[model samples]
Target: MIVVIDTSSLLSLVRYYLPFDKKGVLFEVIKSKVSSGEIILLDAVYEESKFVGQKIILQKLDFLTDKGFLKENKVITKTDELIPLAPTRFLNMVKNQFVANPFQLKKLNESEFEVQKNRFMESADAKLIMYCQHLIKDNPEEEIYLVTEETPSANDLKLFKKIPAICGILGIPVITLPQLLEKYPEVDLGFS
Candidate 1:
């Protein structure tokens, strides 16, 4: 039961807005799971946490890194380690293929222009997807749940499917924050 957290869920918990908090009911549940060594976070997840509105999550990175919780494991054990899988290259290949298709690239560019403008363009989405690909590639067995707040539009949906597609190709499971939360309530998830 390796639970990989995304940035948004981490922010919610740190801000005490979501069910998982230092002392929230769900927090207790997740904390136990983490303590028992079930929940884990990817290194990129830390990158996302740095932008959380609250200071608590940002401040705890050092402690969490030291404790081998928020940070990825340096040593590759049979079960644990950061960047545990290697799906990055695979993801890049697919993304490259998508971008190479003039129709798809034009659609993505138009969508980016109409929506994100500058905040989050196709490049950013590609980067995120590439990162996910990296995760799937490196840690083939670990199940990952992307904890993002961004909802997918019809176009975005097609693009986002690359994650699950990659996971499917690699025989890995990819889910969302709430889905993981609901399924793994008994798991612990908090920093000491």
Candidate 2:
């Protein structure tokens, strides 16, 4: 199974007050997944984590990032075959979803809409959906799942353009990080 992880899930390791030592355990599990060819980390997601205000989160993430970890782990980036406009095309198709999102993109003017749309265009979320779609087309036999911490929107009033919502529209199977841990029972979080 190729679990294409978003920044939400990765930062979630540090975000949810999982305690310092436990976060390390989870990070190690993530590292094992990456080493075993289970997780596909995107460069865009790593770059997008600039807004993480917590120093501890940054430090832990940096540890995974140091020593060419992503490179050595073969973290996937936007492929050359992945045209720059492809993700934008997707954003355009889902423009209504954004306009409905009162929390984030709803109050924008035309120019502001353009800028916000460009932000989504350049986001890891865009590449993630596109890549999942690409995989579905090119490798239907492969099991593709997205691991994100975002909950699937319960109503249109919420931010319906989040990764989970978009994944739902694109027919990509989605699972939460906790569900992933359940699925992989071998990872023993050794705390008594």
Instruction: RMSD for all candidates, in order, please.
Output: 7.9, 4.0
Error of 1 at 127 (Å): 9.5
lDDT digits (tens) for residues 20-132 of candidate 1: 44455565565555555555544455555665565566664334545564333331112123221344554354445333234545577555634532232233333444445
Candidate 2 C-alpha lDDT tens digits along 1-192: 778887777777666634544536666776788766688766676666656655445576564556676667665464435533355666666676544465565466778777766666666777777777876677778888888888765554533367777777667899988778777666556643
Model 2 stretches astray by more than 4 angstroms: 15-25, 61-63, 76-92, 102-110, 154-160, 190-192
Runs off by more than 4 Å, candidate 1: 15-23, 54-56, 59-92, 96-172, 185-192
Instruction: Give residue 46's error in model 1 in angstroms.
Output: 1.2
